[model samples]
Target: MTSPSTATLHPIGRSTPGTEWWRTAVIYQIYPRSFADSNGDGLGDLPGITAHLDDLAALGVDALWLSPFYPSPQKDAGYDVADYCDVDPLFGTLADFDVLQAEAHARGIRVIVDLVPNHSSDRHAWFQRALAAEPGSAERARYLFRDGKGDGGQLPPNNWESVFGGPAWTRTTNADGTLGQWYLHLFDTSQPDFDWANPEVQEEFRRILRFWLDRGVDGFRVDVAHGLVKTDGLPDHLPAVDGDSMGGDSDDVPYWGQDGVHEIYRDWNRVLAEYAGDRALCAEAWLPTVDRTALWVRPDEMHQAFNFPYLQTEWDAAHLREVISESLRAFPAVGAPATWVLSNHDVVRHTSRLALTAENPQGHGIGPDSPGQPIPEVGLARARAATAVMLSLPGSAYLFQGEELGLPEVIDLPGDARQDPTWFRTDGERYGRDGCRVPIPWQADAPAYGFSPSGATWLPQPAEWATLARDVQEADEDSTLWLYRTLLATRRAYALGSGDLEWLEGFGTDVLALRNGPVTVIANTGDAPVALPAALESATLLIASTPFAGTAVPADTTVWLLAG
Candidate 1:
């Protein structure tokens, strides 16, 4: 295991001028907990990720975006880092991370880690020292603190609600039974928000960025990147639907986009750009509209912000076309290229999201054993349609772990077995994110579905998920994995990533036809078979979801045709 400090790190793709490489790159996101487990503890770790580097590289992704693996108390599944500099023992040692970085770089895959600067675990030494009233401590000032006064005298700086539900602030008790004044969290109460206004805090974070970059990290998928800044005056939030205040007096107090966030991101981007030197800064901004979201990627800010509209878009062909067109129009021409994500650790799997019918729509919404439903029989076809649209769009594509295998969302979890705090706090109305965060199934017949050889996994594996594991599907050329591989390989060969999208006019509402030079990708979203355009009548079929032995096309299929 070689440390990045000692390893001979190589730059990716000849360092093209500016950040153009991202325009055509395929980034594969790995949710560490579910990717693989090497310790048999039923938990995926850094070493497990290292072991599976070949799988990702073989998939032909240009880069790998790993979710947080920093040292933590397992609050928010390592998103709350107690220490940013070291690896959590459960995941593996720092040496293991260095080895993983080396291996990934060796395979021509750039590694981008998640950077959570908005907050740190409440248990972090800095926060702990602040609680002790350490004299003139720089750490104490790193967090927002104010004397309990004004308003109700017992009110927290302002009436802000936690994203996980409930009030954002928690009362602190001193050893002498005195009501000590302290400000806590914005997301999970366990994850304390940082005071970005402090100069020391800004400098420390900049150093943190440089630390990873100096260690040969390619870049970062900044977690909640827009949250570093807060409105100066702790203002009360307007009443939300539930009449609860959200996130103190801040510009971002509103549910989605806020004003002050841009400056914070711009500052971080400038610092990161100086350190990154062509590396990218992809953001996870859940802003309201595509135009508003594009504000974060104005060349001086984020290189790419995840376009979530595709995740929420309806399955109709026209609606999907509108989303892609709208995104391309919204993004700034000179900024980083646009990116798309169908599923991630935080959302329901696409299979579950798209599988719903009028009869089974409620089941698809959220519940236990949801993955085992016959929905895939209907959903897999939709999945192919979505893939064609997603890959053919003029932007980078991101695939969540197990997505290529057409894995469905997991819905069943006993009360005590739930891992997501959002689920517990929301009283099961949200069904928790645990369903999407389940361990990955690797073998159909292997115990624990090849995610582990030990007993039950930390989170229950989908009962029949083993059938869709990589090993099983890899052997079947017609499997979902094969389709994904073929699609990815073909798309790569044709420069689909960099090609300009030209939507073919006069196509039926169910058909989504886009041409990239002479190659045309035609997707059918309807149940009835549609005739191929006369212009494409003489075209050769490169790939099709259904058999293309003859000229007649099958229903619910996508055909990639090359102009003769």
Candidate 2:
């Protein structure tokens, strides 16, 4: 295939007919509460997102992904959704969502909403009814409510632990003040896992899918897409492995990446196909392998799954080259385009995470107080280079909010302001993800950095954000924000997305070089500059993560060359 014409690189497939926009689109993730606030409530709402639509349009993204804005007790942010069909009052009414959708479509941008099917808030009406009903009653069947073990059922049902921390099961008191059965919550006690084994549970999600699709939502970002279904029986778990905090490479876990989850997506895919407009589903599954993750997008299931193995891999060229090559190889077998990402709300910002040395790689938790953290400048430099590398690859890409502005995780959040359940459950031992979820900066001088007119932010913003604020960065040509805008425009001009990647060799052990259509992207991760190889010596330079001298590629930099 030739490089995409400079015209809008349509996600609605240049190679095939119909709306497969998701196949190669660059989707921006908006963490609603932190994106912008229009009501002076110090929290972002649907209308706030609507107000900022033009800014996103100017950023040149093809789609906007809103993290859950559903009504909830705020137990696990919006992930513990209490209502799936309506907008949370904290955000706005369904009518407000309609305006946001209409405005976005008017700008030629698609909309995808977050769908948390793996679990529901403990306060959900269904969960409430389950609590009031008897153990074997149909009301309790929607969730994984099981009898406790040991005398008088005092102990939990099994040895499973919460991904946030502590025991996964939460024992409840009966309506009559008696010790009742325990329910499993993979994350927090207030977020109970649904029993996908129940046909009613599966049917309810189908109805939910139809409700949103009917509202013109382009698709759903399936939360914990690998976790809807558990093993046949609620079984005991083996001791957690070194990297098994949330997800890992193990295949036999009782609740993760089960074969049953694919069936659930296959069913959902049928629902998606019924709607026109190239409706699609993107799974947020953290399966152990790229091949295993590819199963969710096997033409009959989700159209795309987050390429987290790429996200989790260390910042080294050989490792990166292997991941890129294997990912490109694995997805085509399933006829799906690989999705690339750098960071999200749930983890430390890649800027900070990449700063860590190999000896102190991060796990589930990170904060300013963490021992031996790397300097901020070093992390940001690597992050900028990594972003360039990601955009040059084949398939779709998802950008976490504020990444374009080079936002680093807010590590200095005070202990009093910590809200992530991981922090509370672990009893202050772990700082949790609140740092990454801090409100983003939009204006260098405006109140709350222009995130809110009231100058109040839900999560505290660090004082250093003044320089990285969007307005400040947008004015500086050498800024990270400018680099992202230029990168996106260059990618579209070169038609790099959704193309075949041919690995090019002889650039040295620390340099990664690949040909995506007419574009050749070279990334140097070595400690010193390297002379450009003969193959790329005469290629036209399109863009680079950092300025270069003559034919030498600077250390920790990525450059895009237009090949003849």
Enumerate residue pairs that collide in model 1: 235-249, 368-412
What range of 10 consecutive residues in model 1 has the weakest lDDT sum? Answer: 242-251
Highest-scoring model, TM-score: 2
Q: What is the C-alpha RMSD of each candidate to the true structure, in Å?
A: 4.0, 3.9
**Tens digits of per-residue lDDT for model 1 on 1-564?**
332233444544446654466777888999888888888898898988887877776677888898988889987999889999888888898899888888888777888889998889988998888887742466578887665656534767677667666676776666677676657577787888888778787778878888887778878898876566666676776434432122221234533345666777777777766653367788777654677678888877778888866666767889888878888888746455678888888766777777664222211235653434437666777776687678776778888998888888775667678877666666754455777788888888887888876745889886778788889998998887887888788888888877788988777888888897667888778877778867788998877875555354556678888988
lDDT of 2 by residue, 159-240 (tens): 9988888899999898779899999999999999999989999999999999998888889998988887788767888644
- The residue-level lDDT of candidate 1 at 151 comes to 51
What clash count goes with each model?
Answer: 2, 1
Q: How high is each candidate's TM-score?
A: 0.90, 0.95
Model 1's lDDT to the true fold?
0.74
- 10 residues in a row with least lDDT, candidate 2: 1-10
Over 4 Å off, model 1: 1-9, 12-14, 134-138, 147-152, 182-184, 238-256, 275-277, 357-365, 369-374, 546-556
The alpha-carbon deviation from the true structure for residue 467 of candidate 1, after best TM-score superposition, in angstroms, is: 0.8
